[model samples]
Target: MSTFPDYYALLGVSKTATTDEIRQAYKKESLRTHPDRLTKATVEERKVATEKFQAVADAYYVLSDPSRRSEYDILYRTKAGNKSSDPGSSQNFFSQFANMFAGASTGAGTGAGPHGAMPGHQPDANGVFADVFEELLRPEVERVVPWWSYLGAACGAGLGFIIANIPGVMVGAYAGNRLGAIRDAKGKSVAVVFLSLGGSQKAAILRALALKVLGSAGM
Candidate 1:
């Protein structure tokens, strides 16, 4: 029952594609979804593309590493299936836990990142973040937010922060405005601003594109 991904499809390459082919595919896709180059599009549009782009980044990040790629391949093949466990084997629960936790922080799982858990834990979290970015880019998914929701989270009021994080970059501006008043046509409601990297249009758009591509994939 293990779920598996057609890694070749993820990279837009055939299964017979060479290592260089994979690398080239990744590079081409990366440039296509670069966020900084998305000035013409709305913030939401850029975010979706970014999420798709991140998927590619993560896939390439793993596929490029031999050991990790092997592990990923094994995991993908058996992720939805089960096998007999070896009691006498050295691999144990602790080791498996360590593998899952890896670079993730303790608090990260309690309620961190997009998953309400740590990285590499729930595929859903990946999907959620990826969904946000994907929606941002798609012309059909223009789910814009009010100006207050983004900026008002800092207030003592019991408002929720709906702005999405773009990995290591600054928060967007939609999350920067004051928390109050009715929505205005001229209000700051751009999706890219919530990530705070809107000023650096080129870099932000590239990231958004990368992430969007990443989320479009299935594993």
Candidate 2:
């Protein structure tokens, strides 16, 4: 129903935030995005803050619920707009999603220079991973995702479970640090070369870090 979410933006957390980190993020967002805190803000800003607060709350609500998180995992993979019937699509999608969120390898840095859209911003044989990463943060129940960064979309990070709501994603998740990418059901290009995961715990970290990067970038 909304744009893709920046989970970190929603909760005011960082991309590398941990569970405890997210908890702290939720608390901070609860304070900042709260309607009560916007007394002097413009009516429009207050309304926006209210919405962001709700989004944060909703994300926290879901991610906090394990069962809900499983469902979210399923949804994130299965909801591909063009993926009509790839029985394995969900599994494949999660594999890729997990990998990309990891960011560059441990010592490797993959940040785009802040001069403004760099060489990667241009549409190419492979859609820019940075753009794809930015797109994933948008929170859309059902809609074509967006590419731009968000101002406060990552609050939903606190509610990571709600990000996809799929069950048993661990089954398909393999062990490795490899290229991360995205593609439509039709096999159109999306993104290539993201990050690799050490495991689920690492995946969580990467996911958090991705959000933080997007947030800091003001996406």
Candidate 3:
């Protein structure tokens, strides 16, 4: 089992809160904890306020992202015993996955029939699995290249131009771009795995496996 910060509680929102609701809660909490508002307070008060402000910002950062929020919800449910007590075990985790798949299928087939299938229709297990897998793997928000990458490229090119002119400029630009791309890829992969696994003791092993898979696929 793993313990995680209660981000929802930190933002003063419920687990089922809508995105707009969460945004509003974050705005309220952030304003209350903003360090500038405590300028005349004691040193200790300012320090505490700063910490709370950062925590609120962190809570908003995680909760505002759909993909990360989904992952957090899984861990939250596990921690709250909404899921099985020992979700860290491979067997238990797979069982939960299967249950989720089944539930999805059931929900999709609602009002179809007592047998949970539409008239003259057979459920496509493979198709359903593929959809679920795709959803799990997809990032809810597409990320743009980091601003620092452009800055790095400009700096590298300038330095190279100063040293060796034309050919050096090309080489420097390529190196900078390659480095940035690699760093970005690794960062995204790690973020996905960390949020999905929730940093549990057993989850470390799973995270390693996930990273290996992503790496092998050149993610």
* Ranking according to TM-score, highest score first: 1, 3, 2
The candidate that wins on TM-score is 1
Task: Report the Cα lDDT for residue 29, model 2.
Answer: 52
The lDDT of model 1 is 0.43
- Give lDDT per model, in order: 0.43, 0.35, 0.48
**Candidate 2 residue lDDT tens string, 160-212:** 33544332222112111011112111232222212221234323433443356
TM-scores for every predicted model = 0.38, 0.32, 0.37
lDDT for model 3: 0.48
TM-score, cand. 1 vs. native: 0.38
Candidate 3: lDDT of 4?
48
Q: Where does candidate 3 clash, by residue pair?
A: none
Candidate 1 per-residue C-alpha lDDT over 134-188 given as tens digits, one digit per residue, 9 for 90 to 100: 4344331122334354444334122222333342123333233432323322443
Clash statistics: count for each candidate? 53, 41, 0
